[model samples]
Target chain A: MNAPRVIDVRGLRYRYPDGTLALDGVDFHLCAGECVALFGANGSGKTTFALHLNGLLVGEGSVRVCGVPLAASVSAGDLALVRSKVGLVFQDSDDQLFLPTVLEDVAFGPANLGLTPEEAAARAKVALEQTGMAGALHRAPYHLSSGEKRRVALAGVLAMQPEVLVLDEPTTALDPPGQRDLIALLRTLPQAKLLVTHDTSFAAALATRAVFFERGRVAGEGGLPEIVNRFHWSR
Target chain B: MRSAARETWIVERWSRGSSPLHSLDARAKLAALAVYLLAIASTSAWTQAAVAGYAVILSAALAASRLPVPALLARAALILPFSATFALITWLSGDATRALALVEKSFLSGLAVLVVIAATPLTDLARALEAFRVPRSLVLVIQFLYRYLFVVADQAHRMRMAAACRQGIRRNARPRFHAAAGAVGVLFARSWERADGIYRAMAARGFHGTFPALAPTRFRTVDGVFLCGFALAALAVRLML
Candidate 1:
């Protein structure tokens, strides 16, 4: 259709090494700048589904992001380029933050993108500033509180300036203030966002489109209000 | 936020100086430390007076470099276990003179390592390895290991605390161990998963195994002067003995 889809998935299936069928025949589509929420209870394939979008977990069928296939036919350099376009923020901030300091972690993406040191540092500064983490640049990620670590982790991805942002359980284990801060920040990023979360209230607050996942299949998909109404009716 | 106490401890104990001692090329310092050790080790057994004088001069140089004296001494003291064994062997040989000399030599050699670390930053040490043309992969592994070792340690400490809190019965030895083992397993699994995430993030960012130097260190006049002084002082003490 019009310039292909930003994210296109077809017949995606996956099983863990332990033979757990984490995802089965999940299909999804997102246009530019849409905010979509992936909702499910634990083990409902939400995280597995999100992992597929970025080529982090390979599955049975095709996954094309910005029209490039997620396979070996795509050269390594090109795959990296594709990855740069798709930013994935993991569920735990500790996993995202391995660097000694916030600035170094935030700059990690740009530095790997072949930007000059100066350019990378500037981008990192801007991204941290965006996340309201500028003053904490020199501080270690381990030292930060749970909310601050989350914000810094987001800043690290934000520095790369990816076109699509995929967040897995972005609000788990946060206090009310931390959760509110994350929600407020999510609303302001100018990219198509795929939010994978178990928090129903959080999905209601941020997602325009909702995809309900159950035992690996796409149970249903619709706009937020439509999905909410349908969910209530079915209940 | 790192507590003020931890931050202060790091800056005081971990941060090296920018003085003459700090700037010696890593290779040169490594060589110097080697020669210093050899000299100390080979000295005659009755050289306590000479060794004491050597220690004073070396400690003074450490002080001159602005490294906190008490912290440096405390760290040096921690290494006494390995040194004590060497000293013990020499003493057990039934030569009183040799025993005193061996203890002094071991202590001084340990002090020499402390001097190098106090003088050179860890990054410079990496650069020193690079200077010797160490494989990029090896250097990268070492750099990552150094960077993440502290992180993993901190993560382990927190997990330990959480396990302690949950076990409730402070004295239930069986459940406490069960909790501890489970926590260790979780930490291992979590770190493994985090390693994967870190690799993906690095790949997405374009890390190709080699770490690019953000800032290049330059060898300057101070580097040369420090090496010469250290060598000369060491020589004067050893020869005069």
Candidate 2:
């Protein structure tokens, strides 16, 4: 009868080598099957916080995902496991996509997770279907429209079968229709989601709970509507 | 759907063809071109026949590619300035013949590379670099460059459109060089930030440096014949010269 905490971060602090502070004494927790939005303006440590979730940015505190401590002592093998278990989709689809074809890009994640080519392809197909990008499997990411690229990028991460999704500014360049499709997709994903965004409207639509980030720490946290109204967005 | 359909058509049109030249391994074509280059470089300035023969062979290759001849010509013409620079340097050295030779060699060599590219797909051309002993790192850089150039170009195009929309210029207005420089600076900073995110995505997916081939290439008997035949041809040309 115990609730599962999908992600646990305690006393997180990060400082750049140039002696600039990025994150200071941050603490957070995410539950399984929950959609949480991290809201903040640029340079508000939203990205820095997201990076720590995937072990991309090493910091001074501890992060435990699915009960495994993401400590410095964890081997590269463990990190790979964590990475595969938690997909990190970047803001720019250009950065998320580096392969020649959408299929290849989607296959990249599962292939790296030790899946066979057939298995990877099968997974990629399902992921692309989920994102409504099934027809673009052979198209180059570079050739895709901005909205298509965003969908393809989402598919790339989905193919990894991550238990938790960490998205940075997911709706930044998307059109209204694309944003709706993305929000709908996010609503259906069975995994926990950590969407970092500046779009309060998108945050309002997709997130069940919200965390406000300001100057590198969690400024406030509560239910979605409360945070939105408290932040003074009338909608 | 229209754009997607258009892209699909272009990719298919570029990728599908029935030229004997297209069927040939990229490595063979590249080596042959390299051998021709060496022979052209080694020949006497008076050997216009050799230069002419090189031009004829390259032209035939380009013709065989079935790509638009005008397009190929326009692309080749763009390189004329660099060739002319070499010719000019040779002329200043009091060697008119050497200048002609330099121009001829440069034109032919540059033409050869272009023809090869026109005949072969960029992916095949990249795979062919393996035969040149091109460092894997360099090959990867070139491959990624080719892959991302369109993305960067599209970004630049968008930025230009955005700027134009604000400035009330329809298109292709001559922005000052400093303005262009600022645009480039913005592009670079954006690209660098994107690259950081890309590295994370790549690392998340277990991208080691080596790009894994979707399918393995088989070296069949025909490949062997082509390799041997090209090697023998190069050797004969070397000996004859």
- With a 3 Å backbone cut-off (N, CA, C), the pairs that clash in candidate 2 are none
Q: Compared to the true structure, candidate 2 yields what TM-score?
A: 0.81
Candidate 1, B1-241: lDDT as tens digits: 3344454336434544577566567767766676677667666644667877688777766765677778777767756777677778877887667666656676778877877766765656777777767886787678566666656677887886776676665775787777778878988987787688778666555567766663555766766676676777777777887
For residue B41, give model 1's deviation from the true position in Å.
Answer: 4.2
Q: For model 2, how does the per-residue alpha-carbon lDDT over A1-235 read when each residue is reduced to its tens digit? A: 1458889999899998888788998999988888898886679888888888888878988999888788778788888888887888888788888876788889988888888888999999999999899998777676688889988888888998988999888888889998898889888889989988878888878787999877888888999888877877443
Best candidate (score: TM-score): 1
Give the DockQ (2 decimals) of all models.
Answer: 0.40, 0.50
Where model 2 places Cα greater than 4 Å from the true spot, the runs are: A1-3, A116-122, B1-20, B45-48, B85-100, B148-194, B207-216, B221-241
Q: CA shift at B74, candidate 1, in angstroms?
A: 2.4
User: For model 1, what TM-score is found for chain B?
Assistant: 0.78
The CAPRI-style docking tier of model 1 reads acceptable
lDDT of 2: 0.77
lDDT by residue (A1-235, candidate 1, tens digit) is 2434789988888999999999888889877888888877678888778777776678898888988888636677767777788888888777677665678788888888889888988999999999999999777676689889889888888888898989898888799888898889888988888988767678778888898888999888998778767766233
